[model samples]
Target chain A: MIFIVLFCFISFPEQRNINELKGTISMIEHERNDIEIMLDNVGMVYDSADGKEVTALTSVTMDIHKGEFISLLGPSGCGKTTLLRIIADLIHPTSGNVLIGGVSPKDARLKRRYGMVFQSATLYDWRTVIKNIELPLEITHCPKKERHERAMKMLDLVGLSDFADHYPRQLSGGMQQRVGIARALALQPEILLMDEPFSALDEFTREKLHVDLLKIWRKTNKTIIFVTHNIQESVFLSDRICVLSPHPGRLSAIIDVDLPRPRTMDIKDTPEFTALVSKVRNSFEGV
Target chain B: MKKLKKLLTSKFFITIVWVVMLIAVWELFAFHVENIKRTPENVQPHLSGIVDSLTSDRKINGSQTALQMVIENAKATLTRAGIGYIIGIASGFLLALFMSLSKIVEKTSFPYLMLIQLIPILGMAPIINAITGDIAKSRIIIAAILTFYPVATNTLAGFKSVQREKHELMYSYAANKFQIYTKTMIPACIPYFFTGLKISAPMAITASILVDTLQGGIGLGCLLSQSLKGAMTRYVFWDIVFFSAVIGILSFYIMGIIEIMMCPYRRTGKR
Candidate 1:
């Protein structure tokens, strides 16, 4: 009986190890099959206000997998927002191409595959919170009833259904950003591009939002590309942090965050989280 | 009573008090003038005398009382000014839309528009009068010219005031140029357009009156010129001035009310 028990215990781990390797292989294969965004050596250069040529981004090649919460982590002027804008088709790349679901960025944009939240809330002052969420739907000519229903659903998702009738100016900065997130998500786009949506909020509010966002991400299963300069924020929220260097911004390193899912504020206090943050911070050297 | 107290303490009440005080001071000066010098031709009328002229049942030219004639003339002037104001606003808005769509157009036209503003209406009125050969039509044209500058400039500024990010947001939604104009540009421009209208309203009335004075016409301007020529009492002249000033003030307030109504968001900081 002791021999049998020992053999079972010994073989269990080996079998599990094989299954783990197989799982990793399949994950890679699945990721390849479901590549949501692909940037092929994208570059952007434009004339500055003083008529001098400024290179905002160079050789920014990246593959964003479906349903992955990736962050473009960089300092100011590192072209993280620029790269995100390029992917959203808000701006064109000077060189190379961006493919979303194997099609051009512009085509993907036309198909309404991307929902972007700006650094500022960008809520129309004229629109109430619920109406602001309905803007994208209204633009797409969705039925009035559906627009209202979807807007309310988004408000509920952001835990702001109570403030649906409030205008943007009536809300705090954190609440405004929550509404912005709700507005972006209301479109039910395949991908979400957030440009430092919480950078303007206080730390307490940001932490709370981080958990809320994770919950929403889990529920929605939409791929999100968050852009931020904060290292800790990147570590706390991202599945992978794409660290970028300034002075003609380029991707320096892509760090995988192997921390457990459904991350809460408690996860931020872990040694693993701090170590990951420092690794991303060190990537900024020699830029 | 509480509402009345609030009203009495309001800015409008303060303005009324100041106006009454000025009238009282003018009446005191008129009363002190030597009886010999206080003839119909030489002396400024007292406030009471001006009031009497406005209230008098005596006919000035035809069967119309002095007050009736004044109202008729005022209505004519206001109609011309009103037509001119509408034309100015519409054309100026269109010009602003055109200029905002292209930086080159703005650069080319803005300087010339500023130069046109510098050319005084007094100088332009007679020339327009000569070309049109009808003083009434020329008066309308002069009012339009006076009203156009501020509206165009203000509307252009409003259109440009939209943040670049907001524009990008619209573009991201695949909003067409027309959609951008209607949904974003027009609503953004409302407050500025109303501001311009507030400035232009009085100018329109003043321009019409000036044009009428320069080229004799059937309006308050004609009445003023006729009164100045000693055809009417000095009190009548003062009454005309008071009525015209009142019209200008009323037009300005009307624009203000429209502004408040159309943009209720501006009233509260809750936007």
Candidate 2:
């Protein structure tokens, strides 16, 4: 009886360990399957004012993962913004499919799964900073108390809690954009879609915001699909840079940025960061 | 000293300075006309005479004092103008809103709106009078017609002035048409709406007074026309002119005040 008991006790942990190993392997497989947004051969064609068909995007296929910071990097007219808009369901793709978490982009938008930030702050001048942050919540018919609480939390997250009552015009351009970011974050969406949000800022403000954004990204762990024409910005901020080229805008390359975590403005001076930036710039040659 | 400097630079104080300078110029001009041109007192009557005409208890039309007559007529004209101004602005804004919503509506109606503006107010007045067949109603209608163009055009322009990116931002939230207008378009168009009001305000007052003058009615315009016929009543004419100027200035400033109240974001003074 004593020998049998000892053997059972000894084998219990070993069996458990093997089971735990299997569980982790399955978890890894689940993570691999967890594509947050899937754009499969998506295309956008606009009918120009002169009645000519303009192809904005051609055969763009990409998969954005959960909690990953990805950038759609390209120059103007590369359809990067158009792609972002398609993902936000602001504009429909002329061909192919876009799935957001196993559902159509339209359905995901209807479910409020996306929080979008534009190049300009786009804050309504009539609404104060806090009220602007509260806009999406208001549209969703969130209770007044919860709406206020969530807006304040978002304001705190962007470090603009003190500017709650200030009007958008009263704040500097950078501050206004921060308020814009807070407004987007207030939605608590599954993904954040930014369309060249920092392109307008001065270089100094831009670098500062980069650090702040990475911190926010780490803290929130939300998947971000940033659209930018800037190479350095994409290299500094994104986990993956999806390089695009214009003239029937199509994906040219996808460069993985393996920069160390908690990256700062200091990384831009590092050779690794410079190499990544050059790689993105060089990827444009495939046009 | 700082308070004094601030007060001197204030808008009200600046307006006062302008008034004083203008009066001095008027006094000089009056003196020149009286002494150098050798004109009679009734022609370009002196400021003192205009003041006397304002305060005098002499009965006008045998029922009202000069001051009392001016007040009654001014009140009647301003009231008609005010009502018509309000109506015109409301309808203009509504039309503009509709025009903005549909390109078809805009294309069809906008040209006629321009045509309405091209028709001289004098030609349009009699047509309105013929249609209404009542003096008071025609006066209101004429005022409204004159006031409509600027509000409609300016507000329409305001609606069109909304940026494409702003529209996309609203769509990103899955906002409906009504929400986009109420939350974004209407509030943004406010400054432009006020600009329309500022322009249309004087036109409304002018239209009301012109209808009265042309059609012959119991308002300041009629009083001026009657006074113009008799040289003895020229002082009263000058007084009416003074009162008309006051009404126009008052309405303009009142619109400005309303604009300030409505658009608090426009106050960039602190920065």
lDDT of 1 by residue, B152-271 (tens): 999999998898878887877787888788778898888899889999999999988877787565898888889888887656678888898988999999999989888765665644
TM-score of each: 0.88, 0.89
lDDT of 1 at B196: 90
Angstrom error at residue A47, model 1: 3.5
Q: What is the lDDT of residue A173 in candidate 1?
A: 89
Candidate 2, B130-151: lDDT as tens digits: 8888889888887887778899
TM-score of the B chain in each candidate versus the native B chain:
0.90, 0.90
Off by over 4 Å in 1: A1-32, A49-52, B1-37, B40-43, B269-271
Winner by lDDT = 2
Model 2: DockQ against the native? Answer: 0.33
Question: After superposing candidate 2, which stretches have Cα over 4 Å from the reference?
Answer: A1-32, A49-51, B1-17, B35-42, B268-271
What TM value does chain B of candidate 1 have?
A: 0.90
In model 2, the number of clashes is 0
